[model samples]
Target: MALAHRILTIRRDPHSGEVLARGGDPEAHSLLERSGFVPVVRRHETYHRLPTGLDQDEEIRLATRAVARLQTVGYDLDTDPVFATERREPHYLSLGDQVRHLAVRIREAESTEEVADALTELTATHDGILAALTKVLHTAADFLQDLGHPADPHTAARLRHLADERLHVLASDLRHVRNDLADRQAVHPHRAPCPQEVAGDEREKSASCPCPAPARIPTTPSAPAAAPPAPAGRRR
Candidate 1:
């Protein structure tokens, strides 16, 4: 990330008197939210603020903790005096960081089988990522279904819609793709492995191997010219 993106400012908003944290990347935002700050999202910016009704002592404590969390992970923070802390909080791998490894595996894959292996973690029958996510959503919905809020039923239904209609559809589609690639055993066209042996009828005995040239970078296609207007229609 850019150095600018790693910088944050935490101070009380002069007008609203709310302890607000501004600037930084999504990781910084995650840290602030994890420290009990609520996110305030706008069209052009997103920031974090201490939750409403917090006593001054609790707000300062939370802000100090947030500063420490950011500093330990290499973020630079400009904070109010009360929120300053020399201590650093230990950072650990978040579930999101673990999930990001799947993308890395897919990106480095050179064959259909390799890709399928990476996707299998997400599409496996009972214990897969999507399956677990669906279960979590359903359970959350069940909890909300009995809540006393007027919107509770609608929120519960929405969760069920997401778990069943949206996530289930996605899981089914990916499972289909994974099954198709299970036995493909096909190497990427542009990523063939070295044969390591020369052909018996080689034309050049001195040649090391008969590998194809590297793949070319595709050029961006230009827009087509606009067609000429048709001639005026004839009168009856």
Candidate 2:
């Protein structure tokens, strides 16, 4: 998990850097910070080692869906002679490919453990895609800024809007993956009852009861009250 956390951190920082470069919302910094954390290394490693097959059909289906969505959002860089000349479409396609690969992995997974592993991979891949998108948008912003004119407000707005929208979607996907994993584990036959459940009331009684009288906190003796001041102008 720690390794997974590190991977996520590495992926998100670059995205945050891109967001900063374009003068986009600074709030993304907080969001990025919240998203990255040290994952449990043992658990993460276990998940990664789980065997799973790639579902090519599902991968293709997801890719097609993503492409359709991108199309709806006017993502036709190749058709735009100027954009095609600039050649940024390749970068976006690369990101799309990474996402597709992860999607395929997820679809192919057989067990809950394998699914969890795939989800982790998907999270990392999505982070990379977001980072790449951020870089491209920042590049576009920079190019416009270098044109001896103020950056095109419309373009900046659009790029920022897209970044924000994608971030939301990614967060939602992450949550869904986590919930699915939890649900799977709940139904896993091998799962042992919690220790607390086995111990029952005896364990609870052994542990200090929260409702018991509170222990007094020790404190240093208070300083003696200050002596009253001498009467003004009177002998001490």
User: Who wins the TM-score comparison?
Assistant: 1
How much lDDT does candidate 2 score?
0.42
CA lDDT scores, all candidates in order: 0.92, 0.42
lDDT (tens digit, per residue) of candidate 1 on 12-107:
999999999999999999999999999998999888999999999999999999999999999989999989999998899998889899999888
How do the residues 1-236 of candidate 2 rate in per-residue lDDT, one tens digit apiece? Answer: 23222221111123422111011122222222222312223633311110124253443333333233333323431121111222121213434466668767656555567667656654445454445566677677656654654547667666666666875587568868855884685433344332333334554555643343557999999999999997788567
Off by over 4 Å in 1: 196-236
Q: Look at candidate 1 and tell me the lDDT of residue 63.
A: 95
lDDT of 1: 0.92
TM-scores, all candidates, are 0.80, 0.31
**Residue 147 CA error for candidate 1 (Å)?**
2.4
